[model samples]
Target: MKEKHTWLDAVWRILLYFWALTIVFPLCWVLYESLKTNPEFYQDIWALPKQLNWQNYADAWTDYGFGKSLLNTLYYVGGTLIVSLFFTTINAYALTRMEFKGRNLIWGLIMLSLFLPGVNALVPQYVVMRELGLTNSIPGLILLSGLGESVFYLMLLGGFMRSLPKELEESAIMDGASLFQKFWRVIVPLSTPGIVTVAVFKFLGYYNNFMGPFIYLSDPEKYPIAVQMYSANKQMEYTADWVTLFAGVAISMVPSIIIYMLFQRLLMEGATMGAVKG
Candidate 1:
């Protein structure tokens, strides 16, 4: 059934649209500001630029080392996503479907850890990284992110996995499929929506991560786009070349925006189904 229309509903819609504009207008302003010169920006912040200058993006790319930072960010994000998602997928399946001793207890323990503040673990993480000789390196950062795993992803996927029918696993079992084979062939494929949801989130977290790179990485060149953008903004303050700084901010925003746009449907589905089923 369609949702009933009412004056309150109409008013709510209008309020939501107004709220949306509040967020979008700033992004629009920043995008246009990135095309203006320093003088033009100061003269009239809201006015359109007389000319489109692609040079801000170029300067942001080269002068700010965004190119290198982008590669490093991708490396960290991709590597962490691959490793974390792999374990999250299998673990979610096991906890949700496969009967095992202490399964619920393990899930409870994992969820319980989420209540503990992440900040408290920083010193121990650093010490462990130092002992393992993984500090100040991209791979080290990747490992750090992938380590401990994410209780959120596990929970989200476990919820989604519960919604899947047991018949698929039973059919695979009748075919003499082993545990790994059943999971690889049957479970993983059906779980794509939930997996995509997890991937999209992990991408955003890794892309915009500042604390991890800032703490673990001493090398400026190894900094991810988030940290690099911060450094670029700080340097640009002296020059007052606000356009390029805005360009860097715009660049950093692009991936998360793009990923969310592409996977929005799956994200909603994963959220809804996970919540309902789990």
Candidate 2:
């Protein structure tokens, strides 16, 4: 039995290593390509750069307007997180904890919306933004992006909330705590894992969003990192600076990486907790 178990463990370890490599290899290749000259990149696609090209990052930062674009991305991401998290949390709390009429129907509708392709609404969304004179504005983009609570987040947090002891809220209510107080002091604090998970998702989504800004933002100065990267790639014909373009891509990815690394534990806990409970 011990011999059989040892063989199984060895096979599992090899499979796990292969799985990790499948995901990690592409990222490593990108990093390697970012350091190579265009000719070298084409010549040896899988090999490491002969020497690290640190100037690529600096060139990308300055010439590609990534510095300004980074700032704009930070604003959009921060605003989206603030607005989306606020609404999602409140909506989740109400749907899960409070009694209401037609709750199931409302939830069903939200689930249906999740199935609708986002592109289908683009024309209408653009018209509304134009009418509101929100085109090319960061706040407008943030508000439009944060229009509704995602069913996924609502359902995830609802599961976590369900797993909590009802007696906690009941005792607070018996102690003369208002509904707002209970939410603010008791539930919100306990729901940290769910909140962190939701925030991480929103942050990543907002940071990487390109289409909305591309269609609405006419001014180059107002463009975010993703748009700026697009612009950089396009201008490479006149500029002929592949290094800067790669650098811009690398820079654009950093914030999302940092955020995921920081909140990875919370994200995993929230996702697994919701999945198991639900």
Candidate 3:
């Protein structure tokens, strides 16, 4: 039987629609603005463009140095994802699945750290990076991000790992599989959904990270898209090329949009599974 819609349900639906419009309207506005000329944009910020100026995209790509920044972002995001995911998976597996001394103590420490403010570590992190001579380089940024494991991801994956059937590892052990073999062959494949969820969240965080790059890097050429876009904003004060800047902003949004579109289903599935398991 179809459930009857109540007044509360109608109110929730209206609020959800309003929230969706709040997000979608700005994106649609920015996209069209990127395709307009400066005169058209200046004449009416809210009006639709009469003609799409494709040249704005070209100008943003070439003149504004977004092309190089795009490549740098890809490299940084990819490397950090690979390194961080590897460590996070291993750490989660060991903490959740394996029997080891001091494991509970270590986990408790990690959980406790979650309550601590991350900003407290910034000065010490910078000093360590400076001492290692790793500041202002792409590898330095990658190392910093990769080594600093996210407590949330660790817990998320750990919870998922705990939900896995113990029999799988038991069978592997009976078959004379080593500890590494059990983890690799039995656990890793089953935990893929959880891993992908963590990856998506991490990708967004690392891709859009501005503070690390801005504080650690001084060279313009080494800047990622976030910093490069920020620099572009500063330059916009003099150039006054608002449309090209809008184009650049649109370009920066593309990768994140694509990632979400492609993996939206898996993300939902993963989150649902994690919630159920927790």
Candidate 4:
């Protein structure tokens, strides 16, 4: 019986290692090719570069307009994150702790919407964005992205908040704390893990959001890196400079990777928050 358990563990470990390699290898290949010129790329797709051509990075940054795209992405994502924090936290607090009419019904509707396909709403979303005069505008794009409570974020906080004892709020009340004080002081501080977890997830999503910027933003100057990369991809087809194209792709990947590495711990805590009760 012990031997059976040991063998199963070994098998699982092997599978996990293989999965990790599948992800890591593609990134390594892209980085490798980014250093080579067009001739070198076709000559040996898998070989290392003869010399590191750092100029490819410069061309990707300047010639392709990636510098401008990077700034625009920061503005759009920053606005979305700021607006979302208030809405997600407040909505979770009210639905879980405050007794209000139609609370369950509201939550039920959110849960139901989660199962529906987002692609189905593209036509309606486009029409609404146009009617609001938001198309091709950064502020308009931010507003469209920040609308509605994020179902996953709300659910994560709700589970973690539910596990928290009501006595915390009661104690705050005894000290003459108002409803707003109890929430911002007690609840937000304690629920940091879940908040960070959801934040990392949302950050990655918004950073790599291509479809939103592509459809709504008609102007090339306003495109995020994701959309800009698509345009770069097309240019490479004509220029045949796959090296610089890969460089642009590499630049686009760096931010998300750095952020995930920094806050990965919060994900584990958030995932397990529902199971343990106070």
Which one is best on TM-score? 3
Cα lDDT of model 3 by residue, 42-86, tens digit: 999999999999899999999999989999999999999999999
State how far residue 164 of model 4 sits from its true place (Å).
0.8
Candidate 2: which pairs clash?
A: none
TM-score of 1: 0.95
- Cα lDDT tens digits, model 1, 15-134, are 999999999999999999999888899999999999998899998888888878988898899999898889889888989999989987998899899899999999998999999999
lDDT of 2: 0.85
**Pairs that clash in candidate 3:** none
Give stretches of model 3 more than 4 Å off.
Answer: none
Model 2, 170-238: lDDT tens digits are 999999999999999999999999888888887877787899899999999989998998898889889
The better-scoring model by lDDT among 3 and 4 is 3
TM-score of each: 0.95, 0.91, 0.97, 0.94
Give each model's whole-structure lDDT: 0.89, 0.85, 0.93, 0.87
Please estimate how well model 1 matches the true structure, expressed as its whole-model Cα lDDT: 0.89
The local lDDT score (0 to 100) that residue 44 gets in candidate 4 is 86
**Cα lDDT for residue 86, model 4?**
71
* lDDT (C-alpha) at residue 140 in model 4: 89
